[model samples]
Target: MATNDNVYRLQGLSCMNCAAKFEKNIRAISTVEDAQVNFGALKLTVKGDATIAQLEKAGAFDGIKVLSENEPPPENTTPFWRKRESITTIISLFFIIAGYVLYFQLEPKSPFTIGTFALAIIIGGYDLFKVGLKNLVKLDFDMKTLMTIAIIGAAIIGEWGEGAIVVFLFALSEALESFSINKARKSIRTLINIAPRKAMIKRGNSVEELNVEDIRINDIMILKPGEKAAMDGEIIKGESSLNQATITGESIPVHKTFGDEVFAGTINQEGYLEVRVTKRVEDTTLSKIIHLVEEAQAERAPSQQFVDKFAKYYTPAIMAIALLVAILPPIVVGASWTEWIYLGLAVLVVGCPCALVISTPVAIVTAIGNAARNGILIKGGIHLEETGRLNAIAFDKTGTLTEGTPEVTDIVPTEPYSEADILSLAHAIEAYSQHPLASAIIKKAKLVEGKKVNAENFQSITGKGAKAVINGKEVYIGNSVLFEEIGSLPRESKQRISSLQAEGKTVMILGTSNEVYGIIAVADQIRKSSFSIIDQLFKLGIQKTIMLTGDNKTTAVAIGNQLGLSETRADLLPEDKLTTIKSLQQKYGKVAMVGDGVNDAPALASANVGIAMGGAGTDTALETANIALMADDLEKLPYTISLSRKALHVIKQNIAFSLGLKIIALLLVIPGWLTLWLAIIADVGATLLVVLNSMRLMRAGERSSIENNV
Candidate 1:
């Protein structure tokens, strides 16, 4: 079952139903083990060894062309009027008008009139009839098969003008659908075009331009002002302000210096720089975003699943109903054969199901493409739908809502020792520890000029604190529990520690074996966008926003209150956070968890929707969460939720209008009022309206001023 697969690009693959049939045809080939087609991406992947000739033969019915993955897609430079389909449509329209003129001026069945109508049908329906006739032999009842049968029936009933008109209108309808879908697809194509194809590489003294794929890791790439980066790498040489709008959607340019990572598609505004390439071209951030988005577009949501299932039986059922209308009326009701047969043909035209079939996919493709352009990567249609339905959201406290870096805020020393003495001693012991709080202490100590004294016999206690010998005295550093075991703490010191904890500051104690030195308070700064994002979510109908953390209950509750969160769960380990998420799910039907993707993987997997922040910087975040916000800030979260809800609404509207139009047209059969003109117009009009309705999602990516301010 495991084998190397070859992916190929496809041309002229526009219909979802035809794409399915083409995939099946490829699988039937003896040389191919399996094959799949991504209708949204217009790509075909085949397993086993199948020649290009074999694949092309399988797709011949729909006139599809297969190209190697390495081959460049042909540029679409031809004007719309010069296209093959357009030329044929124009000629068919001219012939239909000529035929109608002859019908009113001369005899209705005159040889000239019938000959003109025949030309129109042949010109307009040639491609449709070819594919439809082939599918008909295989008993495939798709939209084309229904239209083909209706056109032929109209011709047999001496309605050449109606048949010719039906052919013209259906051709125009498909053209409109193709145009709208391609407009949606252009959003993704724009992303793929953001990165440059070539880079300037320096080897020893000389620099040469090479393809990005040819550049190896650790190779130095030289970038000049106004140049776009060709690969993902770290800067080793200069500083510049780079516009990272392609990767993070930040309108403002970011300043980058030595050791800063730059993405493949960002633009360098000024200054010269040399970067060390870190990833291959295929593994770059832009490449992964494109791959994920294409896969997301292929994934079906709950509504799409329902529509696909409904269409499977709906098409066959329509055929049976058309058959009964043609036969039963002539027999049981004693109706005229010609009139009822004409009515049956009209019913077939209205029942093509093209509008209903395309309703969900068009909206899904547009919304996902829009999200990607705005630096939000939704992994699947299912997740996009679930995000819109989320009533509750849980947040991880440390890195998600606040800046992860902790800084020392206050220092309290006893009467015998000044603040400087406490900091100097604490810094000596903390120099050997790698804890975050220790870093904060060291940073503060470096700000003042003090003698550096090395601590001897440094030992890190597992859950308590560290102890070491400084100036021939054993000093202890940790929480109150560590010093409590050594000696009793004064009542005033306990009250001071409580005050710092109540302000959401982490308190670190420093002392000797028998006496307390002082306490240092450190806290993480809250992000400026946190309050506004939470408030916006509430206005959008989110009922609850909770924070989960491993910090003390007092600290967690203090921070939660400042952000106006509905609840706070503290002192929770990684697994305990997972349990809390499960509990939230039972209380609220649908819940979402937001976190720094690596540590919160368990809780993220348990929630209905897992959103990861700063995905542009970490590969784990991109792969772990259901939705990845590329920017480091949470400015995009509210916008992502808003877009998903709008997509859901548009899909519902499309489905309702598609079905409503068909029902109205079908009702005309009771009084024999339905004609080929009205039936084809109704069907074509419905399909056009559904496609246009889905296109509205393209404008949803424009960020609000409030979001941009952050």
Candidate 2:
């Protein structure tokens, strides 16, 4: 993240084991101090100085090509059948079929028949043997090393036809593994291609098409109906409905007008608009989402780390078992040496670590990519896994559960002062304040004509209210606590404040040091979607839905009852919210805290998972929270939890299925029933099934309406 100079992207990096070995080779270079390969992301980060040629040479065994992070990935224009891997497999298959015909038609020991089988083996296993033999010499025990030993040992035993067929099967399996990885990476590729490469910039008089990279901040972009935005900006003129499904996962077309922020890759519908660019192409929301998703892929899940550690020991143990199978049967039991050795070779083929090594990463990658496409940014696999197990969730009341836009609902005045007098005096003190309650009083004051009075020496009271000097008198505007401190409240005033507070409205007292002037009430409306979201959380097995707020207990309880919350903690400071999160974790196994990302920083950080709302175009929201919902609405909360649970389930299933199949195939060695091709088939079948299972995550969420229309 510091700079792109040392980070590079990789092509043809499909095997996790090969990636690990390649990283070590790069670090061995004298100029390189450290190297790490993120197999899930197919990226490499090298510390110290290293040339591209040097990095490429390190990965040459796997045919990996290194490209600068900024470079665009090359398009695959060649037909699949014409690609190098496919062509090699096809030619090898033809030779194997011809060899089979010659073995039956001519003598089994004929020179031509054996030559054809040897040609098949050489052609199909060139890359495999190249990497496998090098690993063999180093005393490494990867799948390739096991595979190389199996095929060569079979050839030395004079099983020419079996060796050639096994070679073709292994090559075909490798091709399928590559294809499946690419398929899982398609979501990331779609995100990269969402924004247009060119934009129409309004330069002085005439509009001209220009590349997005050439456009700068403050440039005016001309957008017409049915056009996608090329950069992030605010609309300066015109209005339209824009489909932002690709960015926020909201399928509906949201209406956008002057001053509304628009992100790149969103389609503008039914209006011509001019936008003032706010951010460069790389700084857009879509670009950040893409980068975060890639980084999430690189962060290994607990299951992935476990599998990687397990395979380190699992691979070497398989070799030991194979060696024992070959020696003990021939020496201890007096079985035929040729037949028992062949069985040992089959055991090596069955024990290839491909399926187990690939099982968890494929699932993690697919789930993270899918979550990004749905407008939910899951920061890493650890958070994704934690979300699935959350039993309790804490919510911040003001901006998260409520609309956050407070309005002036009621104003009461003493007998000496009129409504106009109260509005004017309160607006004078609150006008300079930036709080949401201040905005509401200011808005209501504008609608009613009030006395033109200005307050001097204004000061804001933290956690209480604001005060200023009006007509040489010290006036105060805050809650009952400030008023009670200055002067005793009359019984009527107390009753009136209590009534308003019970109605879920925030009551602010307006008075001077000696006598009370009146009471002003402001209320923030709850979001319409809040009730259903709470219900959905309950149905999803969330045990406790607690609300944390700084409001009075009366108001907090009033709002909590309406939303059916299980608990409410009112009059809480930022630190109190954090303590509550820790308490919830103690009571429940895991807890999630949802807030506006900035205000609830302490609580969000303390909770097991922090969810931020309205992440689109907001950099702080993206950076601060563990999970960010792009849209301002809470409709996606249930969907995110559902997807995470499904991902966890699939990851477990893939791991169990991969290891289970290998164990069953290893059992076949007891009866001497496993053949070279059959062992290869079992490994290939398990790998293919695991990949397909992980890909189910791509279709887990509902299809966006824009996709439906397309």
Best by TM-score: 1
What is candidate 1's CA lDDT for residue 331? 100
lDDT of 2 by residue, 374-419 (tens): 8999999999999988899899998889988998889999989988
Computed on alpha carbons, the lDDT of every model, listed in order, comes to 0.89, 0.87
Indicate the TM-score of model 1: 0.92
TM-score of each: 0.92, 0.86
Off by over 4 Å in 2: 1-5, 77-82, 90-120, 137-140, 201-210, 408-435, 441-500, 508-521, 703-710
RMSD of 2: 4.7
Model 1, range 1-710, lDDT digits (tens) per residue?
57899999888776878888899899999878999897877778899999989898888877789998655356466776787887898899999999999999999999999999999999999989998887789888888988998998998999999999999999998887878788787777788788999999998999999998799999999999999999999999999999998888786999999999989999999999999999999899998998899889888888899998998888888888888888898899798999888888898999988899889989998989888888899998899889889889999999889999999999999879888888999999999999988998999999977777779999999788898999999999898888778874788999999899899998889888778889889999788899999999898778999999998899889999999999999999999999999999999989999999999999988999999998996888888899999988887888988887778888888999889999999999888899998999999989998999888787866666323322
**Model 1 misplaced regions, further than 4 Å:** 79-82, 97-107, 110-115, 137-139, 412-429, 445-477, 483-488, 510-518, 704-710
CA shift of 334, model 1, Å:
1.8
